[model samples]
Target: MDTGTLALLIPIMALSIPLFRIWTKHQKEIAEMEVAKTAERAAQYAASNKELEDRVAVLERIVTDRGYDIATQIEALRDTREVEGLTARSESGIN
Candidate 1:
């Protein structure tokens, strides 16, 4: 309203604008950090999943090479009544 009040208010308003900008910038930095962390965690999960897939492929190959049938193996594992060991044995005492 008056010259003195206007002079005081103008400097205060100018200082508040810089403080608001600084607060917003800090918030933006924090949000960016959170996004980066989430991306890193997602990458780690993807790597672990890929490793598990590779290990599964290796196991499948080993099983096939040992003359073990995949379908038969899955059926035998699904059978709750059977008490078969990890290694399958034929009726003639051969693996």
Candidate 2:
């Protein structure tokens, strides 16, 4: 209200301006760092998702490829087992 009080307040006001600027600058830097971290995490997630998709594609091929012939594979395995059993019985001379 008085000239003396106004004179004293000017220096404080000037100091506060610089302090506020520094605080806001640090806040902006921190926000930018968080943005960068979020982007990195998103990239990692995308890479992981792509890897999973590739694995699923391989599994799909294994299941759907005609060369995999599930019935024929099972029949071949059964034949081998029967042959082994018959051979074992003959070797033991058991009917």
**Number of backbone-clashing residue pairs for each candidate, in the order shown:** 0, 0
What stretches of model 1 exceed 4 Å from their correct place? 1-9, 69-95
- Please write out the lDDT profile of model 2 over residues 1-95, one tens digit for every residue: 99999999999999999999999999999999999999999999999999999999998887888666977889999999999999999999997
TM-score of each: 0.57, 0.67
Model 1 lDDT per residue over 1-95, tens place: 99999999999999999999999999999999999999999999999999999999999888879775777878877784354532345554765
The most accurate candidate by TM-score is 2
- TM-score of model 2 relative to the true fold? 0.67
Record all residue pairs in model 1 with backbone atoms less than 3 Å apart, i.e. clashing. Answer: none
| Whole-model Cα lDDT of every candidate shown, in order | 0.86, 0.95
| For model 2, the run of ten residues with the poorest summed lDDT | 62-71
Whole-model alpha-carbon lDDT for candidate 1 = 0.86
The lowest-lDDT stretch of 10 consecutive residues in candidate 1 is 80-89
